[model samples]
Target: MKLLEVKLLTDNLSLAEKFYGKQLGFTRCHLSADELQIEMGSSVLIFRQTKEIKKPVYHFALNIPNNRLNEAIDWISAIASPLKLNSQGEIIADFRNWNAKSIYFIDPIGNIVEFIARFNLPNQSTEPFSVKSILTISEIGLVVNVVKNTVLEFADRFALDIFVPSTSTEQFAALGNDEGLFIVSEKNRHWYPTMINAQPFPLEIKFETDNNVVYNLSI
Candidate 1:
């Protein structure tokens, strides 16, 4: 599957624009007075301004070249401090079972953002890692009250298969494949390597599968 676009909520559109467009230097444009769109290689991320009293925070991941993990760390570290994943002050999370390495950071609105390199993928680049090296938006965390039910519902709705090496549990589950995944977890479960509790918020996602089926879903 491939994640084509995602629309998320943000309380402050101007700050998001500055952080993603100016600070990180990604290609971005103002969609409207309350909307900002950012291009991440093959995927597009849209932030819709919201006036809800409670601010919405999300967790999402971008795919990077398999060989550019270190270079990606260096590139993003220049703009924001990478969040440590271990007691050893290590920033990289090595998922040996998944054959992937990931680094995490927070956007200005406290959204947990990840850049992951899956070695099993064919995304190896000779160019230096930069914003252009981002392959696509690969994962989106969807917080729900019940992980099992949400996972089953999404599987039936999208005709998705469980990701290999990711076992479903009461707390967490992952659907789809390495190219794109929906991470379903029970509310209040801390995101991996972080203390932030998961929360439900409004968002939209558009994706396509290997068989050329497209789905536009809102949650």
Candidate 2:
């Protein structure tokens, strides 16, 4: 699956635009006074301005070329500090079983942003990594009240399957493949490598499966 568009909420539009457009080098188009759309490779990341008092932050991951994780890290480090993954001061997260490596960073709005490189994927590039190296929006965390129920609903509604059963549990599940995944996590569960609790806010995702079937999810 591929996430064609992901809509999220934000309270500050100027900062979001400055970070993604000016600093990160992503092209952004202002749809309206309340909406901003950013182009990241094939994916469109949208931020809708909200009047709610509490800011809605989320966790999302971008897929990079299979062999460009290190180069991505170097490129991203110039703009934002790469988050440490462990007390040992390691920045890179090595997911051996998944054949992937990832590094995290916090956006200006406190969103847990990740750039992941899946070694198992055939997408590799000889060019140096940059904003253009981003392949697509691969993952978006959906904080739900019940993981199993959400997983089942997505599977039944979208004809999706669990990505890796062994990597899932009662509290968390990943629906879809490496190209796109809905990370369903129980509410209040701490986000990995951070102590922030997962909280559900309004979000919308438009994605297409490998068979070219498109689906919309709103919550």
Candidate 3:
């Protein structure tokens, strides 16, 4: 599925604005006083303010030039603090299974932001790494009480292809192609890079299929 937009809840709208606008350098189009919309390549990330959402946080990743992972990491570290593993003390990691390199960072609003470079994808940049180098949002955490059923439902409804082959969906499953992935996980489970517990916070996902069919997933 092609991710056209992702709407996430945030506790503070002003803080989210500062993080995406100033820190991440995303071009923002204010939707309203309570909402901020930032352009992430071909994708739109909408941050909606709500007092009802308790401890609003999410894990999402953006695609970057495959050869510019280190350079992009260096540039990002100057603006935001990167998340480091307590065990190895490494900020950048190699996902050999996906043939991708990734670096994690915490946004001002406490969302885990990832910048991953997939070697299998085309990297046409010979220029400097900047915010413009951020391609599309390639992944987003999908928290559900039942992982297997949710994954199957999403795939059936959206006609999304499972990018990662999984034998047991009881724990986790990633649905969709390399362009975008729903990082589905069981509720209350610990997320990667940091051991933050997952919560089924409300979020809206709008995406288009290869045939230009648009679908909305609200949870």
Candidate 4:
């Protein structure tokens, strides 16, 4: 599945507008008094107003060029502080189990955002890494009540593959391929290397498949 757009909540709209538009240098799409859209290379990320946000945070990821993970890290560090591991104060992580490396950082509104480089996937860059090196918004947080069922529903409908199959609900489940995924978990989990806990929030995702099938869904 290819993630095309994600619409979720942000407590501070002005902060996000500045973070994504000015600081991170994302291309702004159409904007209104109440809604905003920013282009992230092959996909778009949207932040919409909610009536109220109880937790006001989420975990999401963008795909980065596998060959330029280090350069991508340096480029983002100049703008915002990367979230570091407590023991080592390290900003980058190597998930050998997934054949991936990731750099984590909090956004202006405290969302645990990540730029993950899945080496097993095709490295689609031949130039210097920048914010433009982001290939797509490849994952979104889905704080749910049942990890297995949620993943099965989407996988069955979209014919998507699982990135990691959770052995139980106590663990997080990621469903989809290297292209995109829905990170689902029922546990009140803190984003890795950070104390910020993810909350259940309304999110809408629209994506297409390799067979040219499209799915526009809300949850």
Candidate 5:
């Protein structure tokens, strides 16, 4: 399934606007006092105000051209500091795993955001950077309490395939299909927790599927 959009709740709309618009470079598509919308290529990320909400610690990824790995890393580093990085300022590459060039950062709201260039994917043309080219939404991460059967049930309902179950770490589960990936993790174990960062509450996460069925989950 392809993720179309993600709606999050935030107590501070101005802060959200500045962080997403100014810091992350996401363009503001729409805005109101209580609600703000930012466009990331084809997908839209919505932020709304909420009095009582859970601030889940989640990490979502973006895909860029392999050739643009250095460019993407440099661009993101210029805007935000790295959460974890090698001496070269790029995210540490795990040769045994995906082996993608990546970098992770914490947004103003404390959400872990990632910029990645997958190595296995065929290299596309090296074109000038555009929002349509590089800033497209790739994945939405869901932080869960555990890998419970209920979580799998939810995945089935959304037609998501269990790509990889957390074996080495009981704290996480990665589920996806051709559309995109959704990572579910045990709460509190991750860097960001709901209670800590009150802004950017997960409201809805949508994934686009091959059959034109956009899988949607609302929190």
Candidate 6:
């Protein structure tokens, strides 16, 4: 299974445009009154308008170049004050982990957005991280009410291979496919979806299969 896109609901289009288009530098692939599509390399993110949505949502991560990690962090800080940052001003840069640097921010809809640069990628020397240096989306977090069932469904339907389960202190499950990785967890978990002045709930994730079949998961 390969991830092609992920869709979420937002009531504010102007804010979406500003954050994703202006701030994040994601290209506008398609747009309409009810929906807006942003391109991240080969992946797509769709934002739809909804009036009934009111629940917390999971956060997602985008991978950039390791060298540009600081640049990405600086860019994000210039636009939005980060909710959390290390002493080095990165969202997460644990050298012991993957030696990756990352920053986290909340969109207008409360979705946790991340810009990360992994150490394993080849283009780590580039400065002021450009979108082209992004290897791929490393992870999309899913904070839900159930983990086992959600993992089973993703594995059964999307062919998501479970790479890691939440530890005793962790409440997230990470799944992977050919395209990238996704993290799933319950609402009770510590990592709650960031709300953009609205409630967050289960959302749909759209992706394409190996056969080029486009499918969506509404959880």
Q: Assess each prediction's global lDDT (C-alpha) against the native.
A: 0.90, 0.88, 0.84, 0.80, 0.63, 0.63
Model 6 lDDT tens row, 77-175: 777766654445435635344455667777766667777665655656544555555555567766656677777887787676665322322345667
User: Which 10 residues in a row give candidate 1 its minimum summed lDDT?
Assistant: 23-32
Model 3 lDDT per residue over 90-142, tens place: 88887887878899988888888899998878965898999899888899998
Best-fitting candidate, measured by lDDT? 1
State the lDDT at 217 in candidate 2: 79
- Candidate 2 lDDT over 132-155, as tens digits, reads 898899999999988888878877
Q: Cα RMSDs of all predictions?
A: 1.1, 1.3, 1.6, 2.0, 3.8, 3.9
Clashing residue pairs in candidate 6 are 55-199, 55-200, 55-201, 56-200, 110-194, 110-195, 110-196, 144-186, 144-187
| Model 4 / residue 20 / CA error / Å | 0.4
The TM-score measured for candidate 6 stands at 0.77
TM-score of each: 0.97, 0.96, 0.94, 0.91, 0.79, 0.77
Off by over 4 Å in 6: 54-56, 85-90, 95-99, 123-127, 131-135, 164-170, 177-179, 192-200, 208-215
Write candidate 5's Cα lDDT for 1-219 as tens digits.
Answer: 556888777666777788777766665567797888988766777888776764434467776676776666667777777665544644644423544566677777656777666666674546855444554566676655565663667657765556542232566556664235666666555443223322224668766766677666775
The better-scoring model by TM-score among 4 and 5 is: 4
Clashes of each: 0, 0, 0, 0, 9, 9
Q: How many backbone clashes does candidate 2 have?
A: 0
In model 5, which range of ten residues has the least summed lDDT?
191-200
Off by over 4 Å in 3: 29-31, 165-168
Candidate 4 global Cα RMSD = 2.0
Which model scores highest in TM-score? 1
Candidate 2 residue-wise lDDT at 9: 94
